[model samples]
Target: MSVWDGIVGQEPTVNLLKSVVASPGSGRDDIAQSWLICGPPGSGRSNLARAFAAALISPDQGLSDQPTRVTSQVLAGSHPDVTILSTNKVTIGIDQVRDLIVTSEQMPTTAPWRVIIIEDVDRMLERTTNVLLKEIEEPAPHTIWLLCAPSAQDVLPTIRSRTRVVNLAVPSNTAVADFLIRQEGVDRATALKAARLAQGHIGVARLYATDRQVLADRDELVIGLLGLRRSSDAIILAGRMVDDAKSQAARAVEGQVARAESEFRQVNGLGTDERIPPALRGAYHALGGKDEVRRRTTRLTRDVLDRYLNILASVYRDVCVLQNQADETAGLVNLENRPAITDLSVRLTRRAAIDRLETIATARRRLAGNGSPLLVFEALFCRLLVSDR
Candidate 1:
């Protein structure tokens, strides 16, 4: 498959990347050594990186004499020729960078070049970035580094200056819907609805479209937030939310683990690999990757939960605005929840609603840090109730 096929709704980026790969020796050829791909969470940044890597390493076609070979590999784990470094523990420690440095200094094995991909590059701690800066500043001629992060500002200034950036924007809703229908085989109606609900996040759209449980869970969570009025109610809701987040995280990761194991078995014969000791080692590594992914998923779920809570907070803020006869658009959630919106507008003043919004924002920030979720919810509920007085 061609590289352009993998990246959806990024024609300009596709053309630029294609030109760079086609002309490896052109005067404007300084684009390949290091690239910082920046975008929102579901904006296809990683997909672009993978496609670019595939194109760079794919075999040359229709060349006469001995064609110039493209020697490269996509390394997610330990490889003699390539290294992909990410956080092995809770944090992206300096030790990981040290290992990356040692690996980068080594020679290529089966290819003319070695490549390194560091996902979640923004997670690199300051100390770790300090260690990585030297290597990034001066890399091996035959080596390439690709880093992916949410935004260029999240990365250190030094790192950003040393690398060319490829910015990928969130695809339009139509593009997202088309991709879901064409690539994912989702029905057009469902795809369109999910695309709208996801607000341009491809990953979120896929989850919303494919997973009924996810949609139900989010709906329940929002409903619970709206119904909560007392401190006890809030506490119970927080507990349920934590449990739901854990379960969803577990189920998602278990599926990934199963897929990885199945792939492992397919690649190496069942009994043959069973007899080889190194085969078990590879299996363990695969499992480890699954566990890491599960942990990340859990963290991500918690973040999503927090955002929902923020949305609920905004709804109350709107009610407060409506009560004070301020601009009606100031705080409405759906605008379509008109009856409830009108009722709330008549009940609370703008000052009261603004106070509630502040409380919600504070709770969200606190929830992101290390605090008891139940206790935080209790405080928030009490404050909101008191404000209603």
Candidate 2:
């Protein structure tokens, strides 16, 4: 099967990329030398980018090479010919932009075209983006840039002006389920369940389908949040969340780091049985970078866990609202925890429920500002306990 077939529910986008690859000179139609693929998280933006790259580097439909009009290469790395700039850390930094600039000036090694794919373009700090603006404005011949972001608004006005924008929408639930089941060997029932729970996020859907532990973790977090009673309880829960974040981060990084270190050793000319060579200094540098990435990822994961906690609190607030006989249309949908939600809703006033929601919102903002998760939860839980009392 062709690589394009893997991109489910993106028939229109697939057609567009195929047309560009099929064109006489790879669609050098305009001076606009870049394209933006924007969509929500897990909407397969990166998958589309990779597929397009594959098509550009090897556009040979039936193995007849006449320098096939469409030949694409896998520039999924920092290669001299085709560069892909992505964050090795949680946020893309200025140094990455500097590297891209240096790479952009180099001549292509083999192909007539040089392509750069920058995933999470929105993560670039303002100063870094400014550094990139000049190169983007006047790209070298045979150079093409592709940027992927969660939405158009995340990109700078200057960058947006110079690029052709492509919007990607979320696939339907049925489509997501079908893709998981057919491609990933997931059972139909499991795929469908994950598709529903993921809310159109393909990555999250896959995690749900394959990882029982992840599902259990989320469920436990939600259930624990519903059981909160006192301010002290909230404080303790927040501490547990922070610890859990660190533990999970370490667990996730262990295997990946080991594999990356082994690959680096191989690339640096070190034999499998030999100790790390002194000349392989650059490889060690890359390993250091990977560790930094792990640290940042840990923080981000912790923040995400805290955010889910807030969502749980919000659900409780909604239950409190329902208890006061508030408008049902405005109630939060906590179908899975319906009994608990119903009980809570019956016990609180609409005003009290709204107050709790306001508290949760404040906690969310505080978390964004790097506030102590423990402190925020303590305050929220105290208020909850008092209001209930």
Can you write out model 1's per-residue Cα lDDT over 1-389, one digit (the tens) per residue? 34455466788888888777767542224445878989887788877776666555545411213323332234133335556665534458777778887877877776555667788899888888989887787887777788999999989999999998988877877899998997789899888877765656788788889999887776676566556667777777777777776677777767877677666666666543465357477755756485677676767566566745644665775576566566543434334454655655555667767877888889887876757666776677667653244
Candidate 2 per-residue lDDT over residues 242-318, each given as its tens digit: 66656655665665667777877777767767776667767676665866766756675655555465446657655
The 10-residue segment of model 2 with minimum total lDDT is 62-71
Cα misplacement distance, residue 74 of candidate 2 (Å): 2.1
Task: Using lDDT, give the best candidate's number.
Answer: 2
Task: Provide backbone clash counts, one per model.
Answer: 0, 9
Give per-model TM-scores. 0.77, 0.78
Query: Candidate 2: where are CA atoms >4 Å away?
Result: 6-8, 30-32, 61-80, 88-91, 262-297, 303-335, 342-365, 376-389
C-alpha positional error of residue 215 in candidate 2 after TM-score superposition, expressed in Å: 1.2
For all candidates in order, the CA lDDT equals: 0.69, 0.70
Deviation from native of the Cα of residue 49 in model 1, angstroms: 1.7
TM-score of 2: 0.78
